[model samples]
Target: MKAILIEKPGDESCMKLGETAPPALTPGSVRIRNVACGVNRADLLQRQGFYPPPAGASPILGLECAGRIAEAAADVTSFRAGERVIALLPGGGYAEESVVDAGSVLRLPDALDFETGAGAIETLLTVFLNVFQLGGLPSGGTVLVHGGGSGIGTTTIDLVKRAGGRVVATVGSDEKARRCRELGADAVANYRSEDWVEVAKQATGGRGVDVVLDSIGGSYLDGNLRALAEDGRLVLIGLMGGAKAELPLGALLSRRLSVIGSTLRTRSPSAKAAIVTAFQARFGADFAAGRIRPVIHRVFPLAEAPEAHRMLKASTHFGKVVLRVRDDER
Candidate 1:
């Protein structure tokens, strides 16, 4: 099999298509002839030696993929050979093939293409688990989501709107603001030129948002805390800004706020499987029903994985940047 390998751990140039042995299907798992793979910021970080794959995970860099099952374990009754599926991986998504626990695989919707399908499951799972289940954003509640034009951001906004929740998003520019609004954000704060705390408060009628989904930590910590309504939930998923931060503990206690930090990649397989099952049971039908759609901005060929990394790092894309492992994966 062919997979992406890193010759060095610093730049996109370190990535290359390399040959490797095929993965064997483990009990309760299935082997996929990968058709497409989703490029994530983590992949770039992995190549730079910042984010290593979890123990016993594939060394190749990729987190999510859509493909057809080529082999299945006898215990895996939900999926079988030749079935179309999408699965999240601890690593090794950028490859010609992948082997994943069957419980973690999603039956691909008939309406979705592999490229976009390859892109959305990870983002969807992250948003669903964090925003709805963890953050407890009510159906009619208001939310403040940072990086509104990002893949995770777009997925978060679309799902919130479809679920009847109001959303306020923060963006880097006017164009990003316009794009976020077009994607169902009720309001957008141009963070580059405006105060997000004020924007969030005003959008939610001066009380503040019921929940805040933030990727930028430290530098934006104060604003995120201030933007939340009383007893609000703040789900911190990334630390793009910095790690250490000084917080107003008095304000947090006074407001009865909850701060939760989370990440998907480092979880146990059983934990990930539980999330996959929960997501399917709760929202699988919506995806098949066309209530939610995968937003794909660009697709690069399998050999161009490095370029895909470059594209994701540029942050110029509004949605997912996927790799086309095979033209006919759909």
Candidate 2:
């Protein structure tokens, strides 16, 4: 099988398309002949040696993929060979094939193509778990989303709107702010020029947002708290900025605020499966109905995984970047 291999932990130059042994099918899992895969920031961090795959996970670089099931273990009855599907993987998605736990697999909607399916599962599941499940965003609630042009940000805006909530997004440039607005964000703030905390408050009539979905970590911690309404929740999914920060205990106590940290990659298989099930139950119909879809910024051939990493690291893309594993006629 062809897979993206890293020669060392460094720059994009470290990655290369190379041949490797195919993964063995495991019980409770299904092997997929991957058609496309989604590239994520975690892949970059792993490439640079800052993040390592969890124990027993594939050392390969991708997090999500779309393809047809090649084989299913005896214990896995929900999927069968030749069925179209998308999977959230622990790793190994940057390849011609992937073997993943059956619980993490979902049938790809007829309305979507493989490229969109590759991009959708990870971002959609991430947002759904953090914003709605963990953050407890109520119906008609307003939430603040950082990195408005990112895959996670774009998905957050779309899901919040579809769920009868509003979004106030923070971006780094005017173009991203405009794009966020087009994606159903009720308000947008260019963090490079405007105070996003103020924008979040204003967008919610000065009461602040009910939830804040932030990935910036330390640098935005104080501001994220300020942007939230009383009893609001701040969900942190990434630490792109520095990791260490001091929490304002007084403010937290007085306002009854909550800070919750989450990551999908390091979770147990059962936990991940539960999240997948919840996401499917909540939004699967929306996908089939075309009410929500992944916003793909670019698609690269599997051989060009290095270039895909470069684009993601440069932070120029709006929404997900995908890798085409093969051209499936179906």
TM per prediction: 0.97, 0.98
Residue 110 of model 2, lDDT score:
82
Using lDDT as the measure, the top candidate is: 2
The sequence of per-residue lDDT tens digits that candidate 1 reaches over residues 1-330 is 888878779888888888988787799999988999998888888899998888989989999999999988888888878988899999888898999887778888878878878998889999998998889998799989998888898998988998899999988889988988888899899988999899888888899999899988899999999999999999999888999899889999999999999999888889999998888787878987756777888999989987888877878888889998876636
The residue pairs found clashing in candidate 2 are none
Instruction: List, residue by residue over 1-330, the lDDT tens digit for candidate 2.
Output: 999998789999899889999999999999999999999999999999999999999999999999999999999888989998999999999999999999899888888889999999999999999999999999899989899899999999999999999999999899998989888899999988998888888888899999999888999999999999999999999999879999999999999999999999999889999998788789878886766899999999989998999999889999999999986543
Per-candidate count of clashing residue pairs (backbone under 3 Å): 0, 0
- The list of candidate 2 runs beyond 4 A from truth reads 328-330
- Give candidate 1 regions above 4 Å deviation: none
Query: Residue 15 of model 2: what lDDT?
Result: 92
How far out, in Å, is residue 90 in model 1?
Answer: 0.6
Give the distance in Å from residue 103's predicted Cα in candidate 2 to where it truly belongs: 0.1
Q: How close is candidate 1 to the true structure, as a TM-score?
A: 0.97
